[model samples]
Target chain A: MQVNFWDRNQLRLTPVFFLAPAMLLFTVYVVYPIFSSLWISLYEWNGVGEMFWVGLGNYIEMWEDDRVHTAIWNNLIWLIFFLLAPLISLGLSIFLNQNLTELRFIKSIFFFPFVVSPVVVGLVFSQFYNPEYGLLDFFLKSLGFQPIAVLSNEEIVTFGIILAALWPQVAYCLILYMTGLAGLNREIVEAGRIDGAKGWKMFWNVILPQLRPATFIAVVVSVLGALRSFDLVAIMTRGGPWGSSTVLAYEMVEQAIFNYRMGYGAALATILFFLLDIYIAWFLFRVWLNEKGRL
Target chain B: MKLFISIIVTVSVVITTAMAGTLKITQNSSNANTQKLWKEQIIPLFEKENPGIKVEMTIYDHEAYKTAIRNFLQAEPPDVVNWFSGNRMKFFVDQGLFEDVSDVWAKNGLDSQLSAARSTMTVKGKQWGVPLTYYQWGVYYRTDIFKKYGLGEPRSIADLMYICRTLKKNGVTPFTIGTKYLWTAAGWFDFLNLRVNGYDFHMSLMDGNISYEDNRLDKVFDIWGDLARKGYFIENHASLSWQEGQAPMINGDAAMYLMGNFVVPNLKEGGLSGKIGYFQFPVIDGNVRTWEEAPTDSVHIPTKAKNKADARKFLAFLAKPKVQSMVAEVEGMLPTNNQSAAPTDKFLKIGFKVLSESAGLAQFYDRDTNPEMAKEGMKGFQEFMVKPDREKQIRKRIEKVRKRIFKK
Candidate 1:
């Protein structure tokens, strides 16, 4: 029996055929590299030369390292402070998505940080954080307060970097929220208005339900962004004043590149990966729960 | 079909371009003078003599080149690469990342000519690279500012403190050093440790022979802390990069900077040389100032370099007094070769005198110690500057890293 060349079943398989290249790329670039990193984490290897088996030696060392403790603590600070970006952006999006004069111009001005590169942002913010003649110092001096060295102070260096990172991050979330707000259905808002729902009430009863997808996306992106914060800290503080501002990602790169401790860096990366995975699992679980309820 | 494709892949991997015609040199600088010496002076001269070979030079900024060197060395290596002497070079040498250039040294009689810098380029009894310029570190001061304050270069800690007091009274920072990248802090530690405890003790400590918490180091920290407490260092120094740290000196807000001879060109470029003077960092503990901070910048052939022969030719040329003087003159730095003519710059002349006469040379703290230890040491030094009271805590932190690194 001759098989039909163009049948419905084969046509249905065409999408899978189309997806094969992307799947292969994802497996090679993303999935494989991660597992390889895990594998390398078990060995003591500088980027060059020999690879010696070290098992859990690097992990044990990292466990006792004060810098690692500082990194984890700083990562926590980043996460907690990073939550402010989405919230601020939501408020910004709402305020700006109105009929105001030069609204597009003002919105673009708020969107400015997102378009600029992280390296430029870090450098610019460093000028603001400069001890002398920095904008921050100038403002403080103008206010009759002694200038605070935010980048130099171990206690507040990470916070200073976080504030700078939030500039671009909040802009990113603003753009996302703006897109979400633009697509808002008006009939439900009218119904909410008929019920005298306005402001917080309207937002809670009508607007927010529609914004759930955007909020979920914004939150996921924000959390991921917080965990992967390397550029600002690398460019600004270099995790200095005794490595007080280093997050795990920054510390990992420092160890691997600067210190030539590739195995240890990989182990740190593994730990960071697991930490991020915990948050991801919770997010996925929440989505699963919501999906099951709907089903 | 699978076998055919696998065979093709294996064949492609096995094939490498013939190593001839072009010599690739990766320079770790974008400085116009260094580039000019390479592109105009060195390359033209090299190609004119060889006639059969050409040069393809690639320049990378210092930091980016450092990170990129590791990868490129393993995959498709450059014929020559710019690097520092001492442990920085030793790091790559230990990994066999650098070619053994001892033959070049032997063939060119560079062993005797480059004797002063040989110890720095040598690792485990093998020389791996050649250096043309290595500069001395000392206090570069504002002469007009010092003269106006009726002060001279300090000869002792007491004299230094007197200058500090005068500068402080005048509302000027006694010294300006940016510790943003941490290495500037290492310069302070090196000087303080060398002055208080002497060279051998400081080196032993750097080599991980002595524990950081040992009482001997306490003296060093105590003396340094005394300076810090007296407000002798630039305020908010941790926020500035080493380059930015010069602002106070340029503006006459600071009287001095403890820095290397490489900064001589910068002073001239900034038009601040009219008021500048160079001196050895003031002595402490009544000990002879025997050791000097002399960091050497070198050229290396990566192990996987396609043109090792041409790379060796470049190395030998670099060892010659003529080529060394040409490059070092432009940079306003002293050539590593003892016979090379001193530059026209007075600051470099003093640097040459200090380096040549010093009983021994230190390749600076970061260059002398293991990279990991150097990084931690610099950070701790930075903290020691900011909070003198935390010296013990910082030492403890560094000691832990030292123990882990050295397996002591």
Candidate 2:
């Protein structure tokens, strides 16, 4: 009845007190906003104006919205491309792991794209894809091919931005894979080689299962990255040539900020959150299973 | 205690400061000349006239200004704010964020002086703000290229088509446009609709009273589609910004561009100023090429402004012919005050002529229409340009957005 919440001497209370700042911050910034957005999603509120509640109207509208489908399709493309990043990064990490001369030095250079901001990365690739003076166009023209308008064409614009996104994404995955590869059990690898497990088989069986933690992290990051593919689409195409390149996150922000459709935007955010939440739950379950198997 | 004494001193100073009342003005531009005009001319002059009043100006660059205006206006309302005329302003005004300044208009007799842009400054029945500056959007063509091809300034739809044909024959694109940001396409739509169906029909459509799939819009898009299909626009235009589209015009590869007077500065930057000539977008229906896209920029006081009395004085000061002329000189913009002389620049003089002869004014498409509808409609316009065959689909898409946006 006379509990002192701030008592540091009490072990259980001490941990709670230690966690209090972070918990408070997380509640305010993360938990509160998530619920607030959910509540807002039920209303038809332009951010500045008074909110008028229209329960389920925004969700019903989303069901009929074709643009949502387009965004999902684009997000799917991003997901597909993102899945390749880990494999590519793993392959790249392994190749660089070899004690070739200056290989370590080359790695920092390769990771240069990751260090560059997404906005800068988007800008650089936009220049590369610019039809008139772009390096890609110039190279294609030199090769006796027609100059390609990748960003201009609606169908390919998402692909173009995704490819740009992958440049940095691959670097991040490469770092993750390299970290995983470093923590690999060398004796098991040596034993696998002794047992005639070589090359691809060595990678598939010996190296991979041990690298599960890193692979899981990379895949999770990639899925999140794909779902939240906003910056590249925003900077390069702006979901343009007719919303063909829009991803859910970008469209949500577009609706909220530009269109002043906060209610609709909040609905989009809720949907994106739920979709990601499902993936996260499945990922956690897989990790739990993997850990249980290890035990 | 020393702390107690310091606190007491601070309280009195704060009270004095509160009584003095700072008139905060938030503007969306930080142009060097404009800033200089504010510091050297307007602020100094206004302060001299009223010794007790202090002007606090907070300026933002374009992109930051766009979002910051909304946030700052509502949270810590400034006495005055700068915004675009027409629907963009109406958006905030309707939300009751901007203070009604019809009293300022009536007292100053602005209804007569600012007659040209008066309609645009009004939302519903009330004038929510005052138009301070505006610039005309029309066709800007390479004078030498036109002369070289004997392209008499296109006077009608037939004339425009003939120019396009003649330019193509000479291996020149008739018009260079970049729809990367989507609003460039809106410029095209505004002109075509204004020309083909005239102003009232165009305003009706923008007001969402007329449907996007109307026969009138069909006619507008038909002409636009024909233009696009003729290979008249810059190649790979959807990838380029309006600034990048200026390149072909600079190089004489494109004969003309339909853009705002803002593009004139870019032309100067591109070192192609003297070579370019201005023309109102030629008649389509030949009824009259009177309705021009001259998007007016307005100033307003927030309804919650602390120093409204000073803000009104500021707005009144902003409305004076000398101040308007100073703005015109400083910004290379058309003055809203009737008495202020238009700038003497060759291009500006012609802009004045075009505007003065106009039967009425139209805010540019994005400025005139609801933002949500404008976003979809511009996208539809961009798509239509790229694939004119999909005109019906595009119109339907825009119509769908319009219905959703305006219905509520």
- DockQ winner: 2
Q: Show the lowest summed lDDT stretch of 10 residues, model 1 chain B.
A: B12-21
On TM-score, the candidate that comes out on top is 2
Off by over 4 Å in 1: A1-9, B1-21
lDDT digits (tens) for residues B60-174 of candidate 1:
9878988898899889988998899877888888888899888898888888989888888887788999987978899999889899989988788889889899989999989
Give one digit per residue, the lDDT tens place, for model 2 in B214-266. Answer: 78677787788998898888889999998999988888789899999888888
lDDT of 2 at B232: 88
TM-score of candidate 1's A chain against the true A chain? 0.92
**Candidate 2 lDDT for residue A203:** 83
Interface RMSD of each: 1.0, 0.8
Summed backbone clashes in each candidate are 0, 0
Model 1 Cα displacement at B73 (Å)? 2.8
Which 10-residue span in candidate 2 chain B carries the lowest summed lDDT? Answer: B282-291
**What are the per-model DockQ values?**
0.75, 0.80
lDDT of 1 by residue, A1-295 (tens): 6677667479789999999999999999999989999989999888887999999988998888888999999998999899899899999999999987889899989999999999999999999999877999999999999999999988899899999999999999998899899899988788889989988888887887898888888888889999989999999988987798999999999999899889999999999999899989999999999899999
True contacts kept of each: 0.90, 0.90
